[model samples]
Target: MRAQRDAPVDSMGAEKCMDQDASPEVHRFQVLVSLMLSSQTKDQVTHAAMTKLRSHGLTVENILDTSDEVLGQLIYPVGFWKKKVGYIKKTCEILKKSYDCDIPPSVQEICKLPGVGPKMAHLCMDIGWRKLTGIGVDTHVHRISNRLGWTGRNTKTPEETRVALESWMPEKIWSETNLLLVGFGQQICLPVRPRCAECLNSALCPYGRNPANRSPKKGSPSKIPTKNGS
Candidate 1:
């Protein structure tokens, strides 16, 4: 899996989801917002939305002052843009009044925000606070972990996979698992009709070990809507 994780991972991923030149405080906020917009939205779409928001001023103050109509326009086309407009506005207010314009420092605290879940909270802590509170199990992670049998059983949800993985995975690797597997899932172990033939770990993978499943023929479902919409 590591072999498949090449330069492309660095070129496009969670690392590039924020503006590095911004002040430390604003940068952290940008990371949280980007993660918020990333749900059910592709990286490219989320990146584009962030670019628009930054151009118009992406600070918490600016988002709060902007009307829901204008804010929706800036982040248009992101999955659930209308709902996100409300979440972003409400979350910003909480951050300003409670966190002094910064995101919550703990995963538990972050999850308390409206529209936030365990996945977003964990990712925010990792990317925003540089602390790996837990694995950020998105669709890719959930699907790939199940495919590889890493979760021990067919975990039905991302949250289930999170608990299963954290139960035994090393403490040090908690942070990189999401990044490592997301790129792998995007490239080889795709959610739908995965190219099992090309996977280096196919020999050991449970799904790949099945003779009929290994190298699907053409005309099979090549794509399916995933959490990332890949």
Candidate 2:
């Protein structure tokens, strides 16, 4: 189903969500690292972990050579840091062995690596490798898409939403969709309250300016009993 585009594209819409300036090679490694750190973690947590990983060395060779325990220690504060450290290390080793110490250029190849799911693969392909072959559906994209009436129904999982959007979203938006919605979700269309009155997409959004307005009514206010003697 098409996301209802009720309003004209904003005058400043093209200026939003600028593509990162990093090279393709750098993007790929960064994507892999970010995806690994992002699982069940907040963006702030992932940023901290990636910052530490950078200090330790970010290349595949460096990651492959590093100890799992050391990696885990550096990536702390990310959810399930200990286990993810092991997974990332194992993934690095696989990359080194299978791809000649280089992160593969193809989404298909990247998907074969340990801990690389479709979401991770799509992210790497878009931002990391610059392939722009697919769309990356994260929590923000999935939630905002449905709220924007792009998905036609409330989807419980990112994968389901991905398949649904991929079928209808034009190929031109394959790469930039996630980034746009991410910035939008973070700044305007928040999970709560949402500041809808000030939102640029309010006119086009099916969920409209205030999701709270649609919530089930509270019935009637309860009155408290008062003592007769005062």
Candidate 3:
């Protein structure tokens, strides 16, 4: 799968979704901000939110200086904007106090920040610090991993999926796994009517191979016979 060179881009991935040309400090800050704004938010919307924040000087000191109302307005339309405002502000305060306004390189330290979780911490570590700490699991990663039989069907959370995947997956691919699966999920193994026919892994995917697992097409019959002509 890694050798396939024609993979589609992940529009929602932190690495691809945010500005990549900034200095290390600015890039790290943008990555963290993007991850914070990504929860329950679309990639395009998150990108727009980051762009808006950039216009207002996206830095720890600048964010700390901005009013809560203005910050919330800038990150408007993201899930729980008001709550995120508090998280972002508190995180910036901690960064200023503890890390000299620079994003910490350690996953444990990054996770100590407000609103930053394992997923965000891992992603930041990989994208911002170029350190492969763990597989950054999100909803898409969780769902697609299960569908690909990389994890058990009962794997219920991103954290669980992360554990399952890391148990068997080589450490070398950890950094790129999230983006690859997210792009695959978005383009092929979708939550609704996935483009199974176009998927290279469809032959091995239980969900893709089993017609009964597929969602019924609009205005079409629900049941589909098995390959054995049942």
Candidate 4:
């Protein structure tokens, strides 16, 4: 599915708001909750929902006990809150009955639970269990990796990218790869007018040197601030 050593890798990891003071279990649950909240939603909105959910007690039992109406109200700021509430409630029940009220550590097992697809399962397992069962190909990881010539093709779906990336990226790097790319995606390598000159991996990136980025006049103001300042 992929060739090894296709692209040179740099020290490409980043610690974002997600990694602060969070234990392994909390990180895993945060990944699960974030995946749920991220459906048709932005990261900031999902983070806010998780914050509110945490304040209201975020155990499996507690989450299951939350009424859909209340859950929807609490998560209304995110996209598709009403639908997400039902998925969350159902997922909690599955966790309690199938996994002994604990989130499963296995990526395969986690995928069996409701509302958890391969990408979500991988994210949960990596962050929650610190196990990189597979590469997590979120929008950013997929987009940036392809643009950097790490993968053979650009993909519209996360699953496709996951399968493709697994062939290229070593298991050791899988766990932290998404975290790094997501941060870079959010900050420098954005969808529009990416700050190519300021990108850390600019030297190794194919897209960074492409004509699209070099077309604009020199000394143009950066679309975003530096990571440290921002």
Candidate 5:
């Protein structure tokens, strides 16, 4: 539980990368940009890159005016920085020309942006636009869902996991699922060698209940459900 409390996602995730006191439009754009930069990248790295970009003025016009090499350097060390550089530039142009330097207003339009995937689009909608259009399924949510027997390992992709979850889970909890599972994965239910012994669900979770997966560690998770609502 204490471990989960200090997971990087709690403070360094994409949702935490925005400038709270910025102008409304700039704040929304920063939220979208943060999600765009988060894919396949660790939370701390993305947060640092966002800090640099924010310091240099994280606006659509500013990013569009900046050159690729400099932008790459600003967002350096994130996964696929070279490709993200192009995504950022092209998305900024689209925002300026089509949306008038603001984020797209809907999930469908948001997904059309370069380098922005379904996961980013959903997160952008929820955080940038305050719309709970769908669940944002990243690696942590996808893996943890399966490990907890929610998906039965049938879903091969994050998108599939999202669809499966939305098909049954209450719409009200969709937004909470991403953050909860992401932090859980970062701490207790890790991708490899998970600390099942540290999880409250270890005695009940399918994978955690497995003898081989449980570690002889001493800790506890923060009120994780054994099943849907236990």
Candidate 6:
């Protein structure tokens, strides 16, 4: 998947924010901020928000110096923008006072920050620090994994799906799994009307094998199995 196309926009956005001449510490700090702004937000929106933030100096000091109203304006349209501003400010304050203005590298320490959860913490560690703490499960991963029978269909949350997947998925693919599955879910295994016929895994997928799982083609007979061996 990495060879097929560029990495997802959030990851790419983080890299874009990292100046070539910037120190490793600065790059990690920028990446952490990017990941924080990305929660419950679309990749393009997150990219735009980061770009706007960068325009005004995307740094822990700059963010803390900015007023909440200005910060909200900069990151407008992101879900819970007001709430996120508070979280970002609190996180920057922690980094400045406790961590000496450097983003913490440990998952436990990162998770202690406001608005930082397992998914965001894991993603920051993986992308910023090149550490594979855990799989970063989002809605796409949770839905697609259940649809593909990779996890129990009853798994109702991304965290549950993450645990179930880690139990069986090979350790080697842990870092790349989220990216690959997220792309697959967006382009092929869509939530409403997946492109099953075009999927490479269609033949091997239980959900894909059942034509009834997909909408019947126009003017075609229903594929749903009937009782009495019809």
Cα lDDT of all candidates, in order? 0.85, 0.66, 0.80, 0.68, 0.86, 0.77
Cα lDDT tens digits for candidate 5, 99-195? 8888989989998999888998898888888889999999999998888878756689999999989988999999978888898888778777687
**Which tens-of-lDDT digit does each residue in 74-131 have in candidate 4?**
7878887777777888877877787776688787788876666887887776656766
TM-score of 6: 0.84
Superposition-based RMSD of candidate 5 using all C-alpha atoms, in angstroms: 4.8
List TM-scores for all candidates, in order: 0.90, 0.74, 0.85, 0.79, 0.91, 0.84
lDDT of 6: 0.77
Angstrom error at residue 39, model 3: 1.1
Model 2: per-residue lDDT, tens digit, 131-172? 677788887788888888788788888888998899898999
Number of the top TM-score candidate:
5
What is candidate 3's lDDT per residue for 16-99, written digit by digit as tens? 555566667877987898899988787777877888998888888999999999999999999888889999999899888988
- Residues 161-219, candidate 1, lDDT per residue (tens digit)? 99999999998999988888887777678777787866768898999998877766696
Cα TM-score of candidate 1 = 0.90
**How much does candidate 3 score in TM-score?**
0.85
lDDT of 6 by residue, 3-86 (tens): 454435425544455555656776788788777777777777778887888788887888889999999999998878889999
Position 11, candidate 4: lDDT? 20
TM-score ranking of the models = 5, 1, 3, 6, 4, 2
Backbone clash tally for model 2? 2
Clash number for each model: 0, 2, 0, 1, 0, 0
Question: Lowest lDDT 10-mer window, candidate 6?
Answer: 220-229
lDDT of 1 at 175: 90
Q: In model 6, where do residues sit more than 4 Å from their true spots? A: 1-3, 6-17, 216-230
